[model samples]
Target: MPSNPTLLDDQPATGAPPSSPSATTIGDLEAGLDRLQSQGPPARRDLVRSLLPVAAVVALLCVWQILSWAGLKRSDLLPGPLTVAASLADAFADGTLQRAVATSLLRGVSGFAIAILIATPLALLLAQVRTLRAALGPLVSGLQVLPSVAWVPAAIIWFGLTDATVYFVVLMGATPSIVNGLLSGIDQIPPQYRSVGTVLGATRLQHTLLITLPAALPAYLGGLKQGWAFSWRSLMAAEIIAVGGSIGFGLGSMLQQGRDLSSMPLVMAAILAILVVGIVIELLVFSPLERRLLRRRGLLTQGAS
Candidate 1:
């Protein structure tokens, strides 16, 4: 047997290169398992994600406090968060902040409502008729890009420092945004949706309202959110210029007065008040709506807030 060299070549040692299924070696299985384990979501990661902003804010406050302790020349200019918080409290206690907030909200919400009423019909007209879209699409886009603040001066000239001026500026800023949002949404609808109603024997108007508008809801919501932002900004800018007119002085006026009086904390508080309003709105209204919509559409995946 030892002498037969031919036997060695014919009998081959390592077994018929393993069956196809055996191609998955232990190392391959281990690597695949490692990949899956790495991808697994952690419970704590969600909690940490929610707290990160709070942590960052705390860090920023610490830095500001340290800077103040170092006796910087601009300490007055860069007041600590606590100082601004105190000023804000005082404003609230005296009804100043409350009055300004109420006045501003009234103007902003009114303008926004009017914008929606106007912008929706306009957007619908453009969306339904190719001719109108071609004629005014660029104009609408241009108006959206133009700063809302720029409208403040024009509004004053037109309305002469009344509540109407504030409303005008807010409308100018918000209307274009709402129209654009709705138009964009309408554009996104599939061609099939238009005919879906026609197949069901709907009249042209009925078809549009039932099929097309329903399909454009996401885009409409986007436009609505954008309109609110525009309205708020425009209202603030108008308030700054139109104070002591027909309306009570607003947050913008408070800021201007703080500046005139050289009250750094007051100025900071006013600025913070503006920011807080935006944050509160997003948290209470916009964020929840967006998240709910996205979650429903399977576009967003996150742990419970």
Candidate 2:
């Protein structure tokens, strides 16, 4: 046969060789594969990390059950998970749990809103004025370290065992955190961003709203989250200790009643409910908001050096 016309010699192999793809096609396939592989690790890691915490909680519950079974602790003093679960079901059936949750959530949200409204302007003022910052910064930072319960005494004195007292305590507990957060966020903003704003002839208000506020959102959000935590804690403390008719039947009051009655199961149920509510608020609202803001600005993954 006439030298068996070589495969490579036949029309330059039309497109790709029989055993190999074109360089561009190979590159595209490699890129796709790399993307797929890259995506797989994060998904697997997230699943594993999520499962690990749940596993640990389950293990702790098992240990608790074992302790109860072994008679290492009195059932009344250290009720097992089953007892607490039963109490939760009973409370739900009686509608007490719903009312308590609603009461606590209302207080938390109201106090948090007031704190944000007050703190935002104060923070802006402090950030822009060195004298104001000097006058207020230390106080704000100091307030962060103070326990929310400490405000209960002063709040009661000023507001006299009313819902206003509880609100006052909550505001005191939360405002410092919000102010400090905004102040620090402003401080941390890059000077270069400010310079760009100045170069663009941005007004003071425009610079703050468009440049500083957006850039410092992460820190501000951080403060808001912490402030909410403080507000919740303060409200609970006030409700539990103040013992006034105006406070209503919040989870904190229920917890206090449980303690007075020596009802371990009820106490446990109240505590669990509080924890669950905090987690739900964070997960449902703040977490998604924070993620959206950070992702939109491409700041979530930006590392500080």
Best by lDDT: 2
Quote the positional error of residue 79 for candidate 1 in Å.
1.2
The alpha-carbon deviation from the true structure for residue 103 of candidate 1, after best TM-score superposition, in angstroms, is 1.3
Off by over 4 Å in 2: 1-45, 301-305
Clashing pairs in 2: none
For residues 73-188, what per-residue lDDT tens digits would candidate 2 score against the true structure? Answer: 78899888899999999999999999999988998899889999999999999999999889878988998898989988888888787788888889999999999899889999
Residue 99 shift from truth in candidate 1, angstroms = 1.2
lDDT of each: 0.83, 0.85
- Which pairs of residues clash in candidate 1, taking residues 3 or more apart in a chain or in different chains? none
lDDT of 1: 0.83
Candidate 1 stretches greater than 4 Å from native: 1-45, 301-305
Write down the TM-score of every candidate: 0.80, 0.82
Model 1 C-alpha lDDT per residue in residues 1-305, reported as the tens digit of each score? 33435445655676454333234555676898899878454333376787898999899889988887777858678787788888999999999999888777777788899999999999999987899899999999999999989988787788887888888899999999999999998889888877777778999788778887878878898989999998988888888777776767888889888888999999988888887887788788887897777656655655654
